[model samples]
Target: MAVSRPTILIPSFNTGPLLLETVEAALATGYPVRVVIDGSTDGSETLLEDLTATDNQLRVHILPQNQGKGAAVLFGLEKSLEDGFTHALAMDADGQHPADSVTAFLELSSRHPEAAIFGRPVFDDSAPALRVNGRKISNFWANLETLGWGIDDSLFGMRLYPIRKLIETLEETRFARRFDFDPEVAVRLAWKGVPIVNLPTPVRYIDPEDGGVSQFRYLRDNTLLTWMHFRLMIGFLIRSPWLGMRGENPLLHLSPPAR
Candidate 1:
């Protein structure tokens, strides 16, 4: 029998120089890394092309137009499945996630291949107070949507997802193709009875002066998330009876790592 291999999927859109840094860090993990360039007009295509030309472990896929983050991720996931990878670790290209923790997360996924491994961020002082506080609302809604399945942070992008299951979940919905990807996927996976594993990892918020770029739109993305939760609530109500009948909650099987 063949063992499961995991790929690191970085979905980037006009991230500029930070893209190279993020890609380098991901490759440092010695895992197969695939970067989906979501029609970035910022010359990232050429940069990535140059890098991939030199690094056999890295592969770059370019989309003709700017698709939302979730769309780019779906593209990568589909490619991963075709390439015989069983899991994909989705990470942001903005240099906020801890690249050093990739090995540990992959190890956890290897042990529990059926569960979604979420990175419960341990943010430093560099993390914006507003951003940190705003995620609480999303987390609250996620727990409610999952009937208290317990998601530590809904907005964090660093997660390890079972490739086949995640692709199936995303195919079932047209939404969650943008900034709402993280939270919506988690809730849906929980609804599908997938196990959840939370691992605490250090996160850094790179200042713009330090070459950080963020694509989150406050007005547009927040509105999308709000509407997403409303739909999830309706789905939750419909699934509650079936959910209650499940004898064991996989969420209760594992405890989040300590800070």
Candidate 2:
């Protein structure tokens, strides 16, 4: 196997000034950073043009129109793969994800290259109660679908994925291309027998006054999740037997060597 080469991938959509901040922080981790502008009409991609020119560590890819978060990420993954990146640490550009944790997650990925490193969000008061509580519904179904494969938080977007395995998982379904991306991918990857590792990471919700923008529509997203889980339940019923006997990935049978 080739040596693990990881890149920080941020998918942004109309995140305004926060986009620059997120990109800068990711670059600060000394990793190659790629940002996919998901058809943002706010002139946000232009904000990084000058910086991207001067900094070899940063690159920006713009889409003609908004295709949703998952589509944006899939674009990044395809490019990253061509760039020879073995893994990708994906985080949000809306200032909710902690960029400082980039090194930790990447380090964990380096140690366990075949496993998925997920961020188990530690939310502060800045996080909205309704949103936090609402995610529980999705999490419950995700765990059940995977036969309790240890998905600490299904909706958290700050996670590191092996580029190849993730692409394969995404190719298996076309519906994870929008708001349903995060949770659906997690559950499906678990079903594929990818080992999961979760680490506690702080998540902060920025206020609008501070240039924080949220694309979440409570009713619409929740409905999407409901439909997503309904489909996953049917899949689970079909896969549970195989998943139970599978136990774990053979790559995970041995302990990771200490760093």
Model 2 accuracy (lDDT, Cα)? 0.89
For model 2, residues 167-186, the per-residue Cα lDDT tens digits are 99999999899999999999
Instruction: List the global CA lDDT of all models.
Output: 0.88, 0.89
Scanning candidate 2 in windows of ten residues, the lowest lDDT window is 250-259
- Model 2 residue runs over 4 Å out of place are 248-259
Candidate 1 lDDT by residue in tens digits, 1-259: 2477899999999999889889999998889999999989898767777779899999999999998999999999999889999999999998888799999899998888888899999988998898988988999899888877757788899999999999999999999898888999999988888888888888998888988888878898899999999999999999989877754557555756323
